[model samples]
Target chain A: MAIFYILLLFIITAAIIAVETKNLLSAVICVGAIGFGASLMFLFLRAPDIAITQIVVEVLGLIILIRVCISRELTFISGPREFFAVVVSVVIIFAIFLAGIKVLETLPAFGTPIFAEVPDAASQTYVEEGLRKTGAANLVASVILDFRAYDTLGEATVLFTAIIGATVILRKKTKKLLEEPDV
Target chain B: MKGMTIIVKIISGWVKVLIFLFGIYIILFGHLTPGGGFAGGVILASCYVLLMLAFGREFVEENLPLPLASKLDCVGALAFAVIAILGLVLGGSFFINFLYQKYLPGEALNLISAGTIPLSNLAIGLKVATSLFLVILVLSMFRPDMSGDKKE
Candidate 1:
């Protein structure tokens, strides 16, 4: 629809502004707008699951970004070269967008999923037999949690490792630890 | 730092309970709904973030200590692995639906269905929610502007 194109244009414009803005807070807000716009695109594509995740992630990331930006000591130095580079990049991006606009129609149509096109596919099996096979009404949940649970385990491990790394790096030293130096 | 205004605090307090319940609902009904572990977990963590912003770090930390959160994070991830290992032991394969194949085979479209999936959802929800909360809590501690208020 025309409205979808308008939303896409708005997101692209926000990304450009976010990149170019000198004010760090304003730049962060613009980036947040771009993320929300993408989430809207997700909803338009009939993926409420991804849209919910994206919107939550955007809000949390924006909070962290704004908090860090406001509290940190920062300095900015710019030159004319940066401006020229920005202009060149913007023009190139716009040119690509204009060219790619025509190619969009060649892609798969919406609402007609790959499972419908291909018989005996893995996802088609999931869609057709998921409820009885896994006893999960939501096929997506069944696929991820039952048929592909090893992958879920890996994801959980990765999250655990990441959180552990963050905790170790950001941990504040205790007074006792600071008082004693190991030779 | 001191929390924002009384108005913000009151409103956040009222909303936080609803947000927590909503997150649990999403996680619990993941087998029958659009939302699952990750989305629900993030929403649950955001509830803590709301409390942190409205009541300051000290109050929020007192309510849910960092050590407990870290332990819960470990437990959630560990639980996921345990579920997989149990599948291998009981069903002769990794990550098999041993529950539905044998025990607790409820009717279709019921809450009790979905063998290991609901368990996985609960585990992942716990892990993600605690991990996110821990990340934000630790990050907030690095706020240089708020250091001055700690001595008060």
Candidate 2:
């Protein structure tokens, strides 16, 4: 327990260093390390699934940050703007932490698994008899892919739109490139 | 070109193999593990990025052209939609695995028993990897001319 607090302190310090740093590349690295530390904390909290997802997403975020850092346009800094941003972020973080701790303390502890509270009605029937009815082996997968399939389709469409938007932006850049001739 | 070191080459090769194997493991075991299609696919792309960093973008672009990667992206997405369509045509809901009982046989908890779930994961993995590679390649290929910018 003490070790966890120590790790949290170290992570918070690292994050502050990252936010205050002038060098973009080193700041990005520090941020990535902080993300990794948060994932470790999640794992310690017995949520390996969340930890894995966090690690994968943060790694990709770091890669994107590194790519952006390499661009010459990202070199400039605005001191006052950055300082205010930090202050706002710190206030928000502290408020969230306090609220979260309060909420955690008030929550009733179910000695058994939390899912036991879910009455055996619609959801239970779906999980157990879904295979027989829907011919899917995995109930959760069936629920996600089959039962809630429309949501999946909607998600895919959102991704497609984002891709199109990105392509549009990139195409404009390519057009600008082609317009210029080397003297 | 002259700054090539033996240590870097050895490490790059090892990283390549590790990334490939890790990606495959993550995608294959996604049903029973913490990983899924998106995670596995990003890992696969990271390998290419790592290779590009250690060697150069030329090595990657030569091996996997932008056009081919784009094609892969389209095909993967089409394959995913087709799978969902198959379920819908069978009078089941879209993306439903209504045909698993006949062909696939295993316990529900087993890794391979998820039927179309695994297939969808593979599709998503392919789509993500190809699209990400294309994005990176296009970004790297751009050479912004400062002289032209100054005139504008």
**DockQ for each model:** 0.57, 0.34
Residue range B1-152, candidate 1, lDDT tens digits: 58899999999989999999999999999889888999999999999999999999989988888778878888998888899899999989988999999998989998998788999999999999999998898888766535655546
lDDT of 2 by residue, B55-92 (tens): 77778867876667777888878888998898778736
Tens-place lDDT digits, model 2, residues A1-183: 776887799799989989788888888899998999999988887766567667876877787778777746655455655778879998999999999999987766634444456787567777678776544454544565556767666666676666556666667556532232332
Q: Model 1: per-residue lDDT, tens digit, A26-76?
A: 899999999999999989987888898899989998998887787544634
Clashes of each: 0, 0
- For candidate 1, the TM-score of chain A alone versus the native chain A is 0.74
The most accurate candidate by TM-score is 1
Predicted structure with the largest lDDT when compared to the true one: 1
Model 1 CAPRI rating: medium
C-alpha RMSD of candidate 2:
5.1
